[model samples]
Target: MSLLISFSHLISRTFLLDFLYLFSVQIAQQVKLNKEFFSLDPATGLDGKIYGLPLYGGTDALFYNPKLFEEAGLDPNKPPKTWAELQEYAKKLTKPEKGQYGMGIYGKTVHAVRIMHYMSNAGANGDILRLNRKKNNSWDILVNSPASLKAWQYLRKFVDDKSIPPNTVELTYPDLISLFAQGKVAMLTTGPWGIATIKAANPNIEFRVALHPTPDGKPPKLRTAPLITVISKRSKNPNEAYTFLKYLTIQIGAEMAGKGYGVLTQTAANTPQVKNNPMMKVFADQQKYAYFSAQELLLAEWLKCKDQAWGPAWEGMLMGSVSPKEAVNQAAKRIKEILGDKGNLIYPVK
Candidate 1:
């Protein structure tokens, strides 16, 4: 009986692939990964026939304070669907004199994705990274493109208009949620995880979530991150291991969804039971446009690049220390340096 190494819920599909790519044959040969669960993102696994199973998924959405909407005379039930409307809502909702802010801008490393996610919805198409068949599986960076510039500029406006919290560049995950739960901010760009966190913090707070807003009139594109599991090729009982893998990811995974846990199975997501639940239904509907970012599968180097490169650069723009275009150009240059030949800069890194 040979050992079966199961990568379930601990590491990501990206890390698993990295391990396999670097140590193929010596450590693994053909791992069983459930790529079907991510049909929303067609480019999820570029290397084909790789490792892992699937797990819970989460995506960014617009979470708003219904009470604040009523107070500001905006439609509480109808959250802003476009960036233009969001600006107007924020204008009305912002009452800095009364310690209320329109939005909670999370510019910290982990939470900064909230802003970039919204940017992607605005048609930036992942901003810094894009898939081009012409590039032979490599990616291109568009951080300095006009769409990307507009996205950051809008974010900068939120800061300049005093529509977001003071010193927003410092807020991160639970911090922004805490502010939103406390009624200090009227809206947030968060996901299902935030709903639970907000409820636990302020059980009586009245809040609602809508799909992420877009600049165009069309529906927004959604972005998601999911935990995936994989079976190492080292396993001797490949057939037996896959049977258990399906049970864990499909069978039991469906059962866990009842408790508000994420389910990667579209069947589980579209189950009549799940569609009946408002929150789960929202996420299920959003899955159509949700895509995993390149960082999830390309190179682990992107994680450090995001933190050390874009994090500070975005913060600088928000703080008025740098212009939005300048900030983005700098981020593009740094990302190119980090990605090297693997990522070509669409805009010159000047």
Candidate 2:
């Protein structure tokens, strides 16, 4: 988060990213103290910066009960391949008759829009906001592309088709979680964090995690959210933080079999040392396909793009307020506004 954009910091002259980078450079030297940090070669990037090194990699999986699959006639061992299968299984598993739902999903929640990037990656035709990757160093919006639109329509199915409860719009993070704990929703598109909640809720729910389902016949290609761990500018122990960050991401992550944490940072997906845990293994598998947000650098523009891009467009689709074509156009226009004229490549970085 850039303090420069913060409402309170609005009056402050310094931009947050700029300020953070000043400290980041110092920590880079500290991190160099540790020779073992070699997974992501900072030198690979033109700036010699491994921006994602501290953040590691992330994943979204279905954490369901092993026991529930058997009871629901689902092969917990072999999770559903497509969204249809997931919906079918969830419908069967959700027995409001038995005081349980098929699946729990947070609908219309404010932050809900933020997480929809998964849909785009799962083959959604468009996103509310996009970072025009073809362009040079500076970033700009490219939201509402065909890819973003396709993803939006596909993800909305679970909600529009009533796969989730109609009143799902009433559900927020807390509400959805509570229902899931009660076993109301049998399956959900979730990350590893849901495991503890499931266990805490019914101890016996028995759940396993799987890749986010694909849209109809589309192939499954999940997108991991960004969570970079930059060196705290004010930290007294910047070196320790940097060391820990590097060690945790490189050595420890590679060593774990199924790291309970959100993601892995090791670049080599199939390295022997990365074969430590099943959880880590699942994450490591994505090193090849994983993509962080394109709008990641341009925070303000991306957020604006998201609102005009996917959010408005998707709402219309869900409410039948607009056709996908119109939705896609709206998103694109917003992206163009943010992109200005620099929507193309530039001279390569020296």
Among these predictions, the greatest TM-score belongs to 1
Clashes of each: 6, 37
lDDT string for model 1 (43-100, tens) is: 5555543344445666777889999999999988888888888888988899989989
What pairs collide in candidate 1? 33-51, 33-52, 52-229, 52-230, 53-229, 53-230
Global lDDT scores for all candidate models: 0.70, 0.52
**Which segments of model 1 are wrong by more than 4 Å?**
1-18, 21-42, 48-50, 110-112, 124-126, 131-137, 271-273
Residue 330 alpha-carbon offset, candidate 1, angstroms: 0.5
lDDT of 2 by residue, 1-350 (tens): 11112221211333534544554434454445223332334432324455434344455666555566788787778877666777677666765556666666664554433345444554434344444334454443333445655655655666555656657655676677666666666666655555555667678655556665665534445555444455556668755666676665556555442434444443434455346546445555543354544344434344555545556665565566776567666656655665577442121111
TM-scores for the candidates: 0.86, 0.68
Leading candidate by lDDT? 1
